[model samples]
Target: MAPEPVRETDPTIGRLVTDASRDISSLVRKEIELAKSELKVSAKAGGLGIGLFAAAGFIAVLAIIMLSVAIAYFIHWAGLGLHWSFLIVFGFYLLVAGLLVFLGVRSVKKVKAPEKAIEQGRQIPQALKGKS
Candidate 1:
């Protein structure tokens, strides 16, 4: 296969090509900025997710410890032929679990997206045009 010859007939064609090149370069820069902004957002989201999961795991372990205490109490009370005392311990466990779940939900609700970077990304093109 032979390579095609390059041709430039009019001055307008040259100007147009230059303008097109500038536009493409501007667009690429804008896209890079957008990607960076999005990556920052994703990183923040991922970090929050990891933190929340860690908290949930900690809460789960605490809940297990509470349940163990309840079991021990149940065994002690049942040994004295009192079954109702076990119910009290079980209820305490339920209350603690419910409170933890409520707190977790509130924490999740407080999480907000990092919007400033995204807004800056949006404004870059306009800033570039003003510079030109």
Candidate 2:
């Protein structure tokens, strides 16, 4: 068997430019996808937080109604301590409302900026400049 002659040639400037352009376009599309995914997660968390807040508000309204009933009972407390029962119920409602509000706040706090995507986006300029 005879050895074949090697035929290697440097890429033309136009070819290099086209390849680079294609790579950059692909990178941009991927970045956009990553951002969309991250935003979806944040949006879901925010929605959950809003729902919890609404529930807490409704419970607070119920607590107010209970308080009104307790007041009415107190007005008729002539040697009768029935107002105490209503007062206890109102307190329990308030406690539950407070718990819901706390959970809502925690969920809202969990909704954060897409740090990974942002960091990757920032690196794009450096990457274009041939820097790591």
Candidate 3:
């Protein structure tokens, strides 16, 4: 890019400094906005995933409950004691709940925040400070 010719009437360095300041301000603002937008998109996606997973877990629990009741009744029909049949169903549900909890924790731990924009933002201040 060619520098504009400095006129004899007005000072050029002052104009250059002002333009640089404005441009840097605009750049930092835009960078901050970009970081914010990226974070928002990431949060929405993660939230949706977590919400869907929770819904799936809820449905699973409901299904397990229904199936347990059906099985307990079927076992009762085969001459097993009623309370013992229900206890067996309860034990099965506990096992399923434990598995769900373990899987949920692992899934959440794997979900990480957006990193690139955050890194760029972190560098902006450092760059402005003349640090590498």
- In terms of TM-score, the best-performing candidate is 3
How displaced is residue 48 in candidate 3, in Å?
1.2
lDDT of 1: 0.85
**Model 3: lDDT of residue 48:** 100
Give each model a TM-score.
Answer: 0.50, 0.52, 0.55
For model 1, the superposed segments whose C-alpha errors exceed 4 Å read 1-11, 80-132
| Ranked candidates, highest lDDT first | 3, 2, 1
lDDT of each: 0.85, 0.87, 0.93
**Number of the candidate with higher TM-score, 1 or 3:** 3
- Where is model 3 more than 4 Å wrong at Cα? 1-6, 9-11, 81-84, 87-132
Query: Which ten contiguous residues of candidate 2 have the minimum total lDDT?
Result: 72-81
Candidate 3 lDDT tens digits, 1-132: 999886798758888899999999999999999999999999999999999999999999999779889999998889999999999888887998999999999999999888998999999999999999
**The best candidate in terms of lDDT:** 3
* Error at 108, model 3, angstroms: 22
Worst 10 residues of 3 by lDDT: 4-13
Better of 2 and 3 by lDDT: 3
